[model samples]
Target: MFAIAVRFDLHDTAAAERFDELVALTVPGIRAEEPGTLVYTPHQVRDEPLARLFYEVYRDEQAHAAHEARPATAAFLEQVRGLTRQLRVELLADLPS
Candidate 1:
């Protein structure tokens, strides 16, 4: 599977919540629209409340590319433009399950 691991540091706790709200909307839309999206999970760090993590798994590079091209993704990016910092994204190769 092709995966992406993402981490974000929000400007504040409030921004984290706002960003999560944006994700809530985006994730469901992706699930409904993209059959190749296998997993899309968002997590909040317990030790650092302002930190957000996302684990996304797709069928292949094409699936991942399709996800990035979605309108929901675009809207989500626009929504969080100023709410985050120290954002990191890692493209991963999943081990055999």
Candidate 2:
């Protein structure tokens, strides 16, 4: 499986609200419409208002690429650009189960 981990830092409560809005509004669409997506989850650090994480899983590299190409993903990216302070993305190969 292929995985994507995104860590984001928000500058303030407002930024965090925007982050939350994007995740809630966009993720379901990605999961429902993208066949290649195996898992899609958004998380916030416990009691930490400024930190956010996204955990994504796909069947393989092709699937991962497909997810990246989806319109919903693009929209989500564009929407969140100014709403975040710092964002980091990491791609990983899943360990054997």
Ten-residue region with minimum lDDT total, candidate 2: 87-96
Return the TM-score for each candidate structure.
0.91, 0.89
Q: For model 2, what is the C-alpha lDDT against the true structure?
A: 0.86
Give the RMSD in angstroms, all C-alphas superposed, for model 2. 1.6
Against the true structure, candidate 1 reaches a TM-score of 0.91
- Candidate 2 per-residue C-alpha lDDT over 1-97 given as tens digits, one digit per residue, 9 for 90 to 100: 7888999888899988988988889988888887888998899988887999889898888998988898888898888888878999997765789
In candidate 2, stretches whose alpha carbon ends up further than 4 angstroms from where it belongs are 95-97
Residue 88 CA displacement from its true place in model 1, Å: 0.1
Tens digits of per-residue lDDT for model 1, 1-97: 7999999999987898899888877788888899999998889878999998899999998999999998878888888979997889998875789
Candidate 1 regions exceeding 4 Å error are 95-97
**Lowest summed-lDDT stretch of 10 residues in model 1?**
20-29
- Model 1 steric clash pairs: none
Error at 54, model 2, angstroms: 0.6
Could you give the C-alpha RMSD of every candidate to the true structure, in order shown?
Answer: 1.6, 1.6
